[model samples]
Target: MIGRRGFLKFFGSSIVGLMTLGGYAFGYEPVVRLSIARYQLTPPGWTPGLKLRIVALADFHACTPWMTADRIASICARANDLGGDIIVLLGDYTSGTDFVTGHVDHRVWAAELAALKAPLGVHAIVGNHDWWHDATAQKRGAGPTFSHKALADVGIPVYSNRSARLEKDGYGFWLAGVEDQLALRRSVRWKRQFTTGLDDLSGTLAQVNDVAPVILLAHEPDIFPTVPSRVSLTLSGHTHGGQVRVFGWSPYLPSRYGDRYVYGHIVEENRHIIVSGGLGCSVAPVRVGVPPEIVVIDLG
Candidate 1:
């Protein structure tokens, strides 16, 4: 039906089109940011005049070549760009089984990661992926896959069922973090046998100052339901904002909390919950409508 000239024209156009799309796909800036969440929480000691901005980075499944040390540097630079007084990483820093294969160099990555800095400081917590390995093989000071020491070495304190005290402008707050629900649930029997004490939110809360507003840095957003109202704000990352929301709806959110909280800010009773979409995709490398995110939250 088509002549030779028409066929050639069409073929050439198709090639050009494909090349254009390929360029975009493989471009150095292929990474797209989904959203920027902003919120204000007033700590109890509440001086109306003070303001502190905190940037949150989470779920960096860095196994794929796409998430390189350069990419992490970019994220840190962006956080600095956002005027963040402090930076927080919600975990899942590495992806795949590098510890088993011995193919991934975590120490090198840690050295590169140490470059990230914020005025107040960088804080972090472990995620499901970080702990989904054989713990018995770990060396002391080496957190699951060397996450604990690596992050600590980078000046980012890794909180695993622990608490830290922070002070800013004469105001202080207690930051408490707990193990991920999925990880805890999966390792219930092992915890009992080892007597290591399973994740106890109640015990973690006991460490906080009752009067000051407590900020919780939990890896999984699913833990919000069980969290008591005593907490002022909860920072989390795990859902990846459903990863692939279509028309504002995500079809494959595997979280127990489900579609109700694929991403963003949610207020519960007296608690403020912020679910960061995270920096990298999990299970698969492709991301559709839901792009990655770095949450910037302000506390006054």
Candidate 2:
């Protein structure tokens, strides 16, 4: 029943008030066109003179608008700006929305992502969200094609407890990626087993030879507790760094160890873990203190 003038005044005031409360306003925008952050990782046996810059992108629950093709294109454009030696995409690529053949249509956004060229290429790992979306549902034969293959089809190799070697500036390091713990939880818990070909933390670690500095790609930070000493640095993305965190605290965390494993760089003995906030929203579309992120890690 409100007139146009009255409605305008009320809605405008509400938006302004929300902004004051740390929420985005009607015209709200990020100061940094893209939220770019940096971290330095010093791992033992790290390739000397490596100076490798890695851009880590994660938790992209590709559900159209939120992680639209355009957004992904923007991400690629930005990563190219950094000129990182390698690009690492730590999983959670799809969300609740079902896909065709258990995977998002790679054709929709793959080219843009592939546009991001790195000497070592782009690597990925599955996340809890990926498992929930990829595996067969209770009543369904197969949900959709939302698995790692989606990325692989576009030339991005999604590693599940696998090792890939990358060399930069004549120095090389081992890039190890693992599957989500939740995906392997069944075997780990009841069967005391593992999904065939899935990443076995111990087995994957054994492949690296411990001679080269290893940078592990683990989608969930909780895997940190289980990682072997062979890993010198681990990059993960499941926490989204508490996607909606406030003052460095999240309402809940799924880390097997605890929330302390939620964000930033952590040093456990000789292993260093860096948890990226990621580039897409999951579960909820809104992001508060935890802005979507693109992390640039320099390994020297």
Candidate 3:
């Protein structure tokens, strides 16, 4: 048995250690670590030695203490400096929590994001948070627009269950974007709530030619399994790399597939998915091992 003094000393040391770690996770980690993840993708039909650079930015969740409008602007500026041929914006531009409603002026965000420079142009897709925040109020009567006007107002085309062909230097590929899978909430009550919307994968694919390579933009990685093998790559950001990873594992990953598609590159049966750690946090304003990131994918 341990003496009283010894037990007290041990308990005190443990408390101090936990506090220090908490401070690091909630403070320094969220603001300091912005990583650039590089990947090489060789989609089907690509000519040998030919490559394309795609930069992906996701989940800004702006207006928070760590991810303010100024921080968002800075992040965009940094992405521009990366010299990517195409830039893809995966959604969740605002935070959502009881304390913070995850609201940001779309017009103002558009101005800052418009500064992004990409040779192939910038394209975007909507996330669940955008739908929750009702970012598509202008087109609500018509259908779910998901920040379409806001992004388009600044020259960024928003794709919802649609596909677009991008060609450059005699090479081209098909890009498709789908609506948020979790956006069709009919009620605010937790137990009564259910999703009514479903992503139209077939509708989006119908616009693309089968001969060319295809890339997809989806807010949630849970849609990966349903994606056809014809899609060369899929980019997503909803998990936020579990927000806080302990020993390289996250317990709070919000996905049907759990940590299988949490973050970084995941390859399954020749199809690829890259889930960005993202630029902001939701629910909780802290990040542990999984720092925010801007993904830079080089395809050859």
Candidate 4:
């Protein structure tokens, strides 16, 4: 039912398209492209006249050819010039994929991150990969994971199930960082959904003893459902914008919630959460429509 000329034409175009797509996914989007995603919001309980600019870097799966120390230092320089009051590292600092030629040392990347500067200081939290890859932490089924120690060594305080109160221009707010929701994840037959983790939302919130609005830094968006109204904003970055989103829809989301919390800002019942696309690749060193990003949030 088809002529040879017509069939050949279709085949040629198909091959070209596929090749273009492959190159974009494997080379361009993953390595060449980086974006800045900005957000402005006014959450409930936010202090009036208190404007906070937060520059968030997430999922820096640093590796040799992909994300080198020089690349990280460059990113930190860009962040430092953003005029943000504070900076937050949203975890997954280590390489998420073994498809790399060399491992970027923990100390190396942490030292590059040390270049980030802000008046309110730098804060951080650990992600699942940070816990899973640490040999001792995985063996102990707990942490002070390698990521935590690396960050601490650079004087960047990691908020592992902790909360810190901060002020900007005499207006106060709280920053709460929960332990990785999927911390110490071990591959087992019976483990799935919300199991084998170290996140303590209740205990972390209880540490907040003031009326100041709360900003929670959770590594994964899976905890967004349980976030209470007391918290003004929740920022997370484990999804990597589904790692290959298309037209704002991600086909293979790692989230249990699927596309529900796949990426970007989501508002439910007046509670808000921003799931950043993050800055590196995982499982595979490839990205298509969802290029890496640095999320900047302006809050009042």
**Local accuracy of candidate 3 as per-residue lDDT tens digits, 1-300:** 989999999999999999999888877777667889888878655646557899999988776566767778889999999999999999987665544534567777777889999989999997887777673432242344436677888889888899998876777788899988877556554332566555788889889875678899999999899998888889999999999998988869889888899999999987889999998887888889888899999988
Task: Give the residue spans of candidate 4 off by over 4 A.
Answer: 187-195
Worst 10 residues of 1 by lDDT: 96-105
Q: What is the C-alpha lDDT of each candidate?
A: 0.70, 0.70, 0.82, 0.90
**Cα misplacement distance, residue 149 of candidate 4 (Å):** 0.5
Residue-wise lDDT of candidate 4 within 100-135, one digit each (tens)?
A: 989899999999999899999999998998988887
- The numbered model that scores best in TM-score is 4
lDDT of 1: 0.70
Give the TM-scores of the predictions, in the order they appear. Answer: 0.79, 0.80, 0.90, 0.95
Candidate 2 structure quality by residue, lDDT tens digits, 156-275: 887876887777766767988876666633343334354322457877777776477788998878778777777778888877676667787777665656677888888877768888
Candidate 2 wrong stretches, greater than 4 Å: 1-16, 19-33, 96-104, 135-145, 184-198
User: Model 4 — TM-score against the truth?
Assistant: 0.95
Q: What is the descending TM-score order?
A: 4, 3, 2, 1
Clashing pairs in 2: 100-145, 101-144, 101-145, 102-144, 102-145, 102-146, 103-144, 103-145, 103-146
Model 4 superposed RMSD (Cα)? 2.0
The TM-score obtained by model 3 is 0.90
Per-residue C-alpha lDDT of model 1 across residues 121-236, encoded as one tens digit per residue = 87888777666542642223124446766777766777778877777877776778886555522345454333132356888888886466677888888788888877777888
